[model samples]
Target: MTVPAPAADGLPTRVRIHEVGARDGLQNEKATVPTEVKAEFVRRLADAGLTTIEATSFVHPKWVPQLADAEALFPQVADLPVDLPVLVPNERGLDRALALGARRVAVFASATESFAKANLNRTVDEALAMFDPVVTRAKADGVQVRGYLSMCFGDPWEGPVPLPQVVRVCRALLDMGCDELSLGDTIGVATPGHVQALLTALNEAGVPTPALGVHFHDTYGQALANTLAALRHGVTTVDASAGGLGGCPYAKSATGNLATEDLVWMLRGLGIDTGVDLGRLVATSAWMADHLGRPSPSRTVRALSHKEQ
Candidate 1:
């Protein structure tokens, strides 16, 4: 598929893509992926020229046994060229990540109350409150924090989330000194119009858009389109997973995130430099999918591999 091109005004023709396959991608798998494979996944991602990769989550073993080896995995690839970030749900998670010498950590919150309670077991306010100490401690230790706000679009239980709620949560995270805020389409219910509306609202509310990133799932196959909408509004950062490895554990019907290979293909075609090699990235995705005993969800990877054959 031919990707679109950006404008020619020399307006900084590069974008930042955060690879989340390690944490969000593998967290929901039924089969357990060994620690060695996870380490190789991070190594291959860095080799693909990805500078930022979410390596694992520091959640409790009972919560996500897939990443229970966070300590083991962090040390295995701690010296990689890319920035390996781990998700820290609370202060305890933060402590675990810090103990492993994690340089960057991500905290998550939802815009709707139902998702907050179901996913994080807290209300929006409560979730933010819980992160206060975590963020405070991480900053004190010189650890960078990236805040994630899920269900930025519509929700399954509650369709069509209020724009004001999204703005409120994003502003709160920014106020809390989050280095960046990633707007997530958790259930993949967002459209380009919704992306524009929310971004505009945040921009009008004096929230810094530059520090904002977009995370879209392809449940409805609109992830790339929504990404375009974000780019048009000057959102330079995007979150994607190799081979589309992640699915929301809370939402049964949700699919994996936008495929990193596909996103890179589109960006390269659009004259936007992502610093990622599409061929190597597809190979990496195929390897991981084979290891997990499942076909990849990345359309670009399948097509590219078939064409090469």
Candidate 2:
């Protein structure tokens, strides 16, 4: 696939692709991947030049059985030359990550009430409140915190999420010491116009574009287009999973994330730097697809891998 050249003005010259295949990608898989495979996936993602890789979630095994081996999986990739940030659902999870010498962590909250209760068993406000102490304690220990706000565009239970509600959640996360906020289109219902509008609202609400990351799901095949709109709006960080690996178990409409290989292909063609090697990324995703007993979902990987990926 070819991407049009980015306009000489307005678009960012560089973008950061936060690889999440190791964590978000596998978290919802029905089969429990071996810890070794999870570790190798992280290693391969880092080798593909993804500086920020979400290694694993520190949630309880009963909640996400796929990531049950988080403790073991993290150590296998700890010494890699990359920033590995694990997801800490609460204070206890934070303690577990800190015990393993984790330098960066992420906390998640939903922008809608239903998802908040379903995913975290709390109200929207209660969910944000749950993260406050976790964010504060992590920051005090010099650990970088990335806050995630899900259902930014559409919700499974509640139709369209209010723009102000999303902005308020984002602002609260920023104000509570999150180093970065990842806006999640959890249902993959966002379009370019919606992305631009939300970013505009965020800027108007005092959130720095630089401190934001866009997490898009490709359920409607619009993740890349939405991402382009975000780039034009000055959002430099994008969240992607290798081979389009991930979906929200709570939001059935949502599917895999934007594939890293696809994003890298577009970025390279646009003359934007991501510091990632497209060939290596495709190879890694193909390997992961092989492990999952299927072909990679990435169009670029399918085209270039040449082995029926």
Taking all chains together, each candidate's TM-score versus the true structure is 0.97, 0.97
The 0-to-1 C-alpha lDDT of every candidate, in the order given, reads: 0.90, 0.91
Q: Candidate 1 on 54-129: residue-level lDDT in tens?
A: 9999988998998889988899999997899899999999988888889999999899999999998888899999
Between which residue pairs do clashes occur in model 2?
none
Q: Model 1 residue 32 lDDT?
A: 81
- Please list the Cα RMSD from the true structure of every candidate, rounded to 1 decimal place: 1.6, 1.6
Q: Residue 276 deviation, candidate 1, in Å?
A: 0.5
For residues 1-309, write the lDDT of model 2, one tens digit per residue.
465476457778889999988899999888888888888888888888899999999999899999989888888999999999999999999999999999999999888899999999999899888999999999999999999999999998999998999999999999999999999999999999999999999999999999999999998999999999999989999999999999888888888999998898888788788999787888888888889998888888999988544
| Candidate 1 Cα errors over 4 Å, as ranges | 1-12
Lowest lDDT block of 10, candidate 2: 1-10
C-alpha lDDT of candidate 2 relative to the true structure: 0.91
